[model samples]
Target chain A: MSALGHFLETAGIATAGISLVRENTELMRPPRALWVPFELGRPFGAPHAPAFQMRVLLSALALLDRTDGPVILEDFPDDAPESDSTASLVCPVNFPKPPNPDESDLLRAVLAETASLAPWHALFMETHGRSIATVSGLDIDAAARYAAAFLEPRSNPEPPEGRDQASTLRFAIEDLRNWRLEAITAQPGPKPSSKTLADWFWGETATGALALALHPVLLESTSPRLRQVGKGQLVPRAQQHRLG
Target chain B: MVRLSDMTADDAAHLLSKNCPSFPGEPFVAGPPLKERRVAIVTTAGLHRTTDTVFDLTDIGYRVIPGNVQAADLAMSHASVNFDRSGFQDDVNVVFPIDRLREMKAAGEIGAMADFHYSVMGAGWEPHEIEPTALEMAALLHQDNVDAALLVPV
Candidate 1:
């Protein structure tokens, strides 16, 4: 955004942006920015709350008049509100986690959950007219299999062409995450919080465990990029809020 | 709050580096005062009219949305699981806020509303891909005489 904001400013358009990540915003140093305390994908506070949304928008626009130069990072005063209820946000499908004490068990468990969710995913595609796999250009099942392949006693060491090994793992991980979210959100009810969904994925299911199990493998890779991406981005994102 | 001096070397380096911009220079000239300015919204929430093409997850490009379109007609195709979608599922004003902006204009909080707003996918990581799109959007906003823009990033 800092880059784009700078480009827009050069065109003589004044811009004030609401930022999700304080670190990224600070790095790019856009001319004007409002740093909100909301999650990564939400700049506005909450759904159905117009007054709050308006306040956020108006506050961001207010930065256009500030005398600060080059970059302005203003913190929003309010924290994001809590969700109204969990019962209201219940996901109908329940894929129980199999006992996963080791890497093999974790992989097997994740595949099992994936198998359970496949029918729901298909139904979602039928109803919504599109599938997550179609949009992401990844086969969720194939991706999971790729992750599982890492656990083989002697798996191929080569990364997919034009990409490193950890990058491949990260995309496969995201593909699996997308698949699970799609299946759960497909049911007719309020969507769960990201944390709640994460808990369900890592705790109730075996997804997070599988990712944690992959960490040593990623960290031990010969490529620096593979190790960096795994340690720096992938592991932190997937298991940042691990409770166990 | 943790003092800056107490931070580890890695944390400090990351913090200092984050303050740098690609095209570093003076800030843009602020437009007219808020009361007299024409305002518009541009979001990175992956919002679009249901009929429009959904943003590719990695698309750094943008889609123009008419300012007067019904909020109900909008849909979000954002790929990140980190965002909470319940609010958007009920009312897009939480992210797009076209209706609220109109209300502000009606009440004279701002002088007028721009004829159109814009939205772009927020998950893009590459600067080269995003820069051209931003330039294109700026040109369009310039044509509309938008004095000030409120950008909502998801």
Candidate 2:
């Protein structure tokens, strides 16, 4: 992000940026930056926080008018407001545990879980007027099937048009995960924090179990792309502690 | 919460070891006052219209997001799964902040909003690898008479 700022400033346009990582910003030394204490995905403090978002925005934009020498990295004074932890998310579906350790049973559980989440996901779409699950180019059911197919010993489901198997599997898993997260969040409650949602998805959900089960299978696959996905893309590092 | 102290050791070390390109000289261009400068957002969040192509692992190119874009029309395809996305899922303003920018424009906090904003996936390439794309976007911003750019990352 700071690199882009440097390039834009060099091109004669003044640039100011929100620095999520102050160390990186200090090293690269962009023309002007406001070092925000927010998390990685959220440069502007929190969701649904307009006043705080304005303060962060104004602080960064305020740097543009400074006539001081280049490399101004100011820190935002306050941390982002914490989410309402008292209001816990109540997951609507109660997925039964797989009957056995076999991959087929896990696949069935995941499929059933996907089917159970569909209406809530539909509610998410209805409320938000959008869904990020479109990345895989497959509907929620197809994404579930495509991802679950990977557990088969020799089955290689065809990817969507113009996509390769490894990429398709990665996206299919993302779509299912996103669909599920969106679905669960649509239940009536205060918004959950990212950590809460991640914990629910990675620690308690059947889809999470399916992903954990696939990690080894993909890591052992001959395809380098699938191996790459297994190594890093399939699961977030923060949640890797949950891996069996 | 993204401070290095808050992250796992491995994650913190990975971020510390990530490449950050340095240029020869400090180049700072003087621009108009905040309320008189045309502003645009240059994000590395891999945002695009839902109908647009998804960003590949090593895609260094950028997608143009028009100023009038709706929150529901945007989607993220960033290659990295390391970052938190639930915030963005709940509110587009958390990442894109287009509505905030619009409100700023309405309140006369800035001179004007540019007609276009730019987004690129900030992974799978070296920091210097983004220079060309940045230069291209700078030219486009110039064409739109934008004097100030707010760089956002995810």
Q: What's the residue-level lDDT of A59 in candidate 2?
A: 91
The deviation in Å at residue B39 for candidate 2 is 1.1
**Candidate 1 Cα outliers beyond 4 Å, as residue runs:** A68-70, A84-193, A201-236, A239-244, B1-22, B25-27
Number of backbone-clashing residue pairs for each candidate, in the order shown? 2, 0
> CA lDDT of each candidate?
0.66, 0.86
Q: Any runs in candidate 2 off by more than 4 Å, and if so which?
A: A96-100
Least well predicted 10-residue stretch by lDDT in candidate 1 chain B = B1-10
Best by TM-score: 2
TM-score of chain B of each: 0.81, 0.96
CAPRI tier for the interface of model 1: acceptable
Q: Write the per-residue lDDT of candidate 2 for residues B20-94, one digit (tens) a residue.
A: 766543789997799999999999999999988888888999999999999889989888888888788878999
Write one digit per residue (lDDT tens) for candidate 1, span A1-244.
6666777787788888887667777767778888887754456777556778788878887887787676788999897665523733333335344444555666667777778777777676565554333222336666776776776555754545554465566667755765676676566665566556655555555666676666666677666755754565454443444523
> For candidate 2, what TM-score does chain B get against the true chain B?
0.96
Docking quality of model 2: it rates as: medium
